[model samples]
Target: MKTDQEIMQNIRTAIDDCTKGIDDAPSLQYQIARKAKGEEPVVKKISTTIVLVAALLAITAVAFAATNGIGITAFLSRIIGGWNVNENAIVAPVVKENTSKWLNLTGTEAYWAEDGLSVVLKVDSADDEHVVCYSNEDGLLDETGERGEQIAINGEMAPLDQWRGEKELIIAEFSPLGEGWNWYKRTDDGLFVIVTFSTPDAEALQKGTDVAFQIQDTNIQTGETEECSVTLALPAMTMQEGHK
Candidate 1:
């Protein structure tokens, strides 16, 4: 039986040979080295060849695991260490927020990449019968159905149909990922809204930038609308390179 040193050497050689010519080989090598150093005692009784096979299998397993919903970019992020991937996008840390009587901001997340900027806001409302509406420009309909508008980023107009549109800025109802789900849960006090925004020029709404949202809180049962404007500070973002 080969000594531990020899076994480790063989494992290193096998990993080097297998990862040779790979673009992310350097990162893989570093991770393998770190793993091997920490696992020396655990593999002490194992044969050199078995160790080599196990290491190779580990690499394969990682690649395979990424295919099961977790993206390759996220897998690499975990191995190389840098960003956090959510829904195939590298997201920044959650930003703290303040609360208002109508809209209570819970949490915020933002991601900047070559594709564009993605922002997700978790919000709560106290009005059980209220419907939240958004507009990019002034002249939004007030509670009495009077048309009014608000200032928007870059003079862009909010999509006519907040739920479906190709507009630059869109604020839609949040639906959790899954199948067969209609109607969001309604509590005694309020409801939760997951607002997502995707825009090519997301950089405009940088940290400390206050974005004015023209919101109409309408009572669904009575058609009564309470129009209000809320300015939310864009949370700090964790910018990362775009993934192909």
Candidate 2:
């Protein structure tokens, strides 16, 4: 009869030999003939266990190869065919038609506009937040003077007298500062675009950085003195085949 220590040593040796592909007994053949006659056969049991483990490993390797693309052999070919595009195309210059009367309000030196609300050309110190354009829905400033009531910004409504500054106010009820003054409009392009400008201020300039962030490009542009320009990508519609 093998002692407990001897059985343990045999088990350890069997594990090591299995990993090294070595076999001290007939490969995976469990000779249980003696065991069926009431005799213990430990070696046969160890052999069966190693064979079962080896079979499992073989099956796992086959499954892994099938799931993960064996290697990068089809990498380039797959990407090219998977992604195809219509490369034939043309590039045309975008033209705009200007209709707003305020485009060149300061002077002819302003930036040229192809579309009244598509873009704005301005002299130096341009205010990118005051230009008026069409609004699809009710906006901060509406087309009718009647809807200017109840407008607010950052939760605060503009004071009546100071709404459009004293100069822009024509009537007490129409003042931008009025309780419901709407000084903004929503554009057909699905956005709100306003343009406002201010003269050089020592206090506003002394802050070093810009206090008024809405002034798109306040710096000077080439070929002109005191020139500034701002282009707004508004939500607009296009004709699709049948729709005009």
Scored by TM-score, the top model is 1
Clashing pairs in 1: 137-150, 138-149, 138-150, 139-148, 139-149, 140-148, 140-149, 143-225
Backbone clash pairs in model 1 (N, Cα, C under 3 Å; residues 3+ apart or in different chains), count: 8
Instruction: Tell me the tens digit of each residue's lDDT in model 2 across 1-244.
Output: 9999999999998998777745444653344665566576454245876676556644654554467543222111111122121112101112132222223222111111111111112221113333222221222343244335432333366543343332222111111111211223222222122232223223432232121111211111111112223222222222112210
**Number of clashes recorded per candidate:** 8, 25
In Å, residue 198's CA in model 2 sits off its true spot by 36
lDDT of 1 by residue, 1-107 (tens): 99999999999999989877785535556656767889533334678876775576558547655666543332332322122344444343343333234555443
lDDT of 1 at 163: 19
What lDDT does each candidate get?
0.41, 0.28
Off by over 4 Å in 1: 1-101, 127-208, 235-238
Model 2 spans > 4 angstroms off: 1-95, 103-144, 147-150, 167-191, 194-244
